[model samples]
Target: MPIYNKLVRDRIPEVIEKTGKKFHATVLSQDVYIEELKKKSFEELEEYIAAETGAEALEELADMFEILHAFAAVHGSTIQGVEKIRKEKEQKRGGFNERIFLVDVED
Candidate 1:
């Protein structure tokens, strides 16, 4: 009966029940949900950074991707809308594909 007071995916309870494990979970209020999602995003990012193998990294990245979608919805936008903004920024300022590292500029 370990305690895990954190946000989880919607199907987690069902998955736990199939294992005959009883757990208690509460629904977060709108404000709290947003806050928790932010926390979860950081958690996922840390896991992604710690991943050693390519497959493990991709798995962590997928988790972060899910969090990104949740964030977009919480902010009243869809993933498509986010992608559109990203493309516009890319067109204006370009993306990281060039791997350019900027040094200090002269004053």
Candidate 2:
């Protein structure tokens, strides 16, 4: 029955322990989680914009995906669940396969 589950990353867990906060605690507050996700996204965006290497951009993008996944989890959904819905919609309507029309963008 703990609030705010601990998200461990390197020395974070140890640091939190020293600070007397419970590690791996369950997150029960929706508002708190939303704010946390927003902060995470902002931090990731900063790094993405400051990145000097192509690999860094990819890493930042991965971080963005993680943030999205966490947001879905907070709302009781998984990434797979989203994909299933997307696939169903595509099947019912049209997917990239049906978009035969193509044009060069840079031209």
* Best candidate according to lDDT: 1
Candidate 2 RMSD computed on C-alpha atoms after optimal superposition onto the true structure = 7.9
| lDDT per residue (tens digit) for residues 1-107 in model 2 | 45643343446667878988775645436887688678778888899999999999999999888887887787789988877888999889778876577566784
- Candidate 1 residue-wise lDDT at 87: 100
Model 2 quality (TM-score)? 0.55
List clash counts for every candidate, in order: 0, 2
> Model 2 misses residue 24 by how many Å?
14
Off by over 4 Å in 2: 1-11, 15-28, 85-107
Evaluated at residue 2, the lDDT of candidate 2 is: 55
lDDT (0 to 1) per candidate: 0.96, 0.76
Q: What would the per-residue lDDT of candidate 1 be over residues 30-96, giving only the tens digit for each residue?
A: 9999999999999999999999999999999999999999999999999999999999999999999
Give the distance in Å from residue 59's predicted Cα in candidate 2 to where it truly belongs: 1.3
Model 2 weakest lDDT span, ten residues long: 1-10
Q: What value does the lDDT take at residue 42 in candidate 2?
A: 88
